[model samples]
Target: MAAVIFLVAAAAGGGSAVWFGAQGWGKAANQSPPVLPPATAEVTRQTLTATSEYDGELGYGVATTTTNRLTGTITGLPDVGDVIKRGQSLYSVDGDPVILLYGELPAYRTLKEGDEGPDVEQLERNLEELGYDGFTVDDEFTWRTAAAVEEWQDDLGLAETGTVELGRVAFLPESRRIDGLEVELGAAATPGQPVLSHTSTAKAVTVQLEPSDLADVKTGAEVEVELPDGKRVPAKITELSTEVQAGSGQQEEASTVVIAVAELSGDKAIEAAAGYDQAAVDLIVTTGERKDVLTVPVTALLALAEGGYGLEVVAGGTTSYVKVDTGLFADGRVEVSGAGIDEGTVVGIPE
Candidate 1:
């Protein structure tokens, strides 16, 4: 009976194996292992430097505005945005003959050195009537001009500055004229006032500094000014007035300061604006820098078995895990300090 039972059990086990083989399970077990896909990686480097960057705008160095001395109608003046030179004739007062007055002027009236018109004779006659000598009514302010100015000042009870103050002559400042027609010919002007505008534009820049950043800046700080044409101009902080000016954003409680910079390299555009341009300005102030550090991509690190972090290194088609220490991060890279990993070592990426 025991022999018969053993034969039956062997026959049952054989039948079961035949059924499973016909189902393809046996053939699948004998198939070759699966091949992994290719992985991308980067080699480690010993020397790595990190940098921070900022973006801003380009602007003019200086800009000047003009106002009128006497309130008059706009007349006999160049149009706006016109370039002018020193001593250019801007406008005339009325059709009336001009009178020149100065506390420092000679008592005898004489034509200026550049005067060559018929008015020169009239000037000489006027000077002689004032009882000044050295001029034969020749219409010129000569050395006798100095004596005449002293006499004039004495008569007016005013101190002489060795220069004439032409207050009465249709009364325009010599060597400079109105830049543009600020008022009309019939406009009335008061004594000792500005009728035309003038600007030097020598060394100027329009700098916009954050009021909150005042702690990092002051007058005389180094600055770099860029022009619209990609020109980089060197400048130094000159004025740091706390006064806020009009800008794109207007906040009653919020505040900002306008900084003025002077070009140290003597830029022509800056000099013209007198160190104050209407264009925008950009400023670069470095906060810090770091260099020569080991770094890696943030994606390469993996959790290790012993509660540490590691990366997988591939060599000879075999993957070996490596443990590493990490440090600072800048941009997309993180600084790492590790052992058994030399520069240019290719690390494997996990599947």
Candidate 2:
């Protein structure tokens, strides 16, 4: 039985099996590194620097709202977006004086009401031109005035409350009236109806910063704004709010901030203002420049068993792991600031 077992084992080639396997493994290990080409890499130098970005908008530096003081239908006036200077006459009210109900009429009221002067006429003309068709220029609030008021209220969707509210007059739409806000036209508003809106006069860029980066922001930091049209506007940081906004996904809670008072040079200012209202703002507050410094491909810098970093430097056909002090890392190259590693040194990547 022992002889028969030996014959079967020999046929199976017991000794040859281990030897062939070892030989194949050795050949594979030897040729692996060279067979697959060493990853070709380039080295560069790092420099210390700062960069800035302005994430704000470009618009008229000042935004303002004009309101309708009297309840009336809109009449003749410049179309929305007409630029006006201070003290420029914009819109006028009609000549029909609105019946101002006073709980107690004063002795002076009779004289003032009857005084039909140019001021009242001018007010009427202005109001008529401004779309206030509720009153005639006869300088008195008559039945026709009431009819016009009701008609105006119907057009503006306001309740037929004839008594004017001064607040309603202050909140008129200067340009295109939006639907979401409280100050809407075509609504029957009384005296004091808020019809106008005002926002930031100047255009600015708004951006949200990650919480980790919030500390880096401050007022008066120099910033650069890049427009989608490839235009860059330089500006100083004007404000930074500490309010943190929650992110929707993948992003952490961040703070949205606005930067104003941008310094746009020449026609670039006009170019920036053209589409800045809806433009995406890229704010850069850090400035960086490329400089010549000792740098190596980041992969070469390995964490050594000891402290510091290590790299395989090939010299005279011999490779040695040399320790290196790394500096700033940029452009895929680590700034190497140590001895033993020089420029153009052929380094071997680990097996």
Clashes of each: 40, 59
How much is the lDDT of residue 110 in candidate 1?
32
Instruction: Return the TM-score for candidate 1, rounded to 2 decimals.
Output: 0.38
lDDT of each: 0.46, 0.46
Per-residue lDDT tens digits for candidate 2, residues 136-173, read 77656455545555555555456665433442332222
**lDDT of candidate 2 at residue 138, scale 0 to 100:** 61
Residue 130, model 1: lDDT of: 54
What is the C-alpha RMSD, rounded to one decimal, of candidate 2? 17.3
Give the Cα error of residue 305 in candidate 1, in Å: 15
Candidate 1 wrong stretches, greater than 4 Å: 1-204, 225-235, 245-254, 260-283, 291-351
